[model samples]
Target: MKFLIVEDEESLRKSIAQYLAAAGNICDWASNYDQAYQKISIYSYDCILLDLTLPDGDGILLLKYLKKLNKNDGVLVISARNSLNQKIEGLSLGADDYLIKPFHLSELYARIMAIVRRRNYNGNNVVKYNELEIDTSNKEVKVNERLVYLTKKEFDLLLYFVSNKNKVISKSAAVEHIWGDDADMADSLDFIYTHIKNVRKKLTEAGCKEYFHSVYGVGYKFTDR
Candidate 1:
């Protein structure tokens, strides 16, 4: 999953980013409100770690802006403010979860996983399609009750396809979601084709049907039909 860390504290931001990265997640950091706003305007994130107090503006306002863009991105507010009113206001303003300062990184990771599952997969840690079962919490994929080893990118690719089942997902959208702002640096989207091919091969080898389809001049779709 892709995450945006909007914390002004340099050490904390780096620590959080490193932790999430180690867990096979792509993370981007923003030191202040302006940087956060700029990043949000350009790239879409699966989840955001936002600090309520920033050098330029309040995080609540930024949260409102995020909602305004119809992103529906999961947000976990991390703040030093532990007042009841602050927590209430942040939750009421569409924050998915809240974590007070001085918390363990493990707890934060758990919260993030919970929120991501809730937002994208309807709170189910396990996502099932036919004989294929994906345990999002464990990052495990199984076919017919047998474990199937998948590279991190391949796993993420499959999850992305399943999440948007039956919809035609553009190559550009996939690139941005998978690679984020770095997509701009790519010379071509040839890499996506390679990943898709590998994912399809793995599933087929596991006795799964071809659910992924190319859309001619458009993009790719995941459909039973």
Candidate 2:
């Protein structure tokens, strides 16, 4: 999963990113509203951990912006404010969930998984496409009941592909999704091709039908048909 942590506190932001990364997920962060705005404008995430307060602007406005752009990115508002009106307003603005500050990282992760599952898999933990069965909760993939082991990156790539099946995913988008926005500093995006190739090879070897199709001059597509 890919997530953006829009937080101001350096310690809390790093803590969230580290916890999510340890669970095999990609995470990017912004210390203020402007930085967060820039990232959201350029890249989309499976979930956005939003902080209501920022140095430059109110985080609530960001929610309004996402609504204006009609982006369906799941948002979880994490704030110290416990007011009922604030929670109500955040949800009304399109946040999928809300968590109070100083909460357990485990609980935060669970909420993120729940929101992603609801948004991408229609609230299901298991994803099925032809002979492929992915247990998102367990991070397991199976081809016709035979387990297919995958590295964390490989698993994330497969999930991203399946989530947006049949869409043309540009190399830049794939890089941002799999490696986070920090990958923009990398020398090249050629590494993306190698990862995709490896994923295809592994799935095919596991008896799963080929579902990945490379789009010339664009990127790749995963389709059941």
Candidate 3:
């Protein structure tokens, strides 16, 4: 998973990012409203860990921007303010969940996962598309009840595709989602082709129907038809 930590506190942001990264997620962060806005406007993320208070603007403004753009990115507000009115406003503005400050990193991770699952997989740990099934919790894929073994990267890629089924997943989007910060150091996007080829071959060999389609001049689209 790829996440954006929109937080102001350096210690808390680093703590969250470090924990999530160790758990196989690509984590990036923003220390204030402007930085967060810049990242969100250009890139996509599976989830956003938002802080209600920022240096320049209210976090709710960012939430409204996301809504105005019709973006489906999941958001979990982590703020020092825990008043009923603040909670209600955040939730009403489209936050998936709220976490009070000075909480354990483990619980925060769990909340992020819940938001991701609910946002992408309809709140289920398992995802299904006809004969194809994915046990997200275990990172397992099966076709017609037969197991399909995939590398960590392959599994993540497949999960990404399934989660955003039938959508045009741009090359940039795929690279960012999978590589996160490492994407900047990489020279080119040619590696994306290699991964896609490998995923297609593995799924086909496993007797799964082909669902990936190349969109010329755009990106790849995963669809049943």
All-Cα superposition RMSD per candidate: 1.5, 1.2, 1.4
> Measured by TM-score, how close is model 3 to the native structure?
0.94
lDDT of 2 by residue, 89-175 (tens): 999999999999889999999999999989999999999998999999899999999999999889999999999898999988888
Tell me the spans in candidate 2 whose CA falls farther than 4 Å from its real position: none
Residue 43 error, candidate 1, Å: 2.3
- Scored against the true structure, residue 169 in model 2 reaches a CA lDDT of 94
lDDT of 1 at 116: 90
Per-residue CA lDDT of model 3 for 1-225, tens digit only, reads 889999998988999989998888889899999999999898888999999899998999999888887888999999999799999988998899999998999999889989988888889999999888999888899999899989888888988998888899988888888888788888888789899999899888989899999999888999999
Candidate 1 structure quality by residue, lDDT tens digits, 136-212: 87999988988888998899889988988989988888887888768889999878989999999988898888998
Clashing pairs in 2: none
What's model 2's lDDT at 5? 97
Per-model TM values vs. the true structure? 0.94, 0.96, 0.94
Clash pairs for candidate 3: none
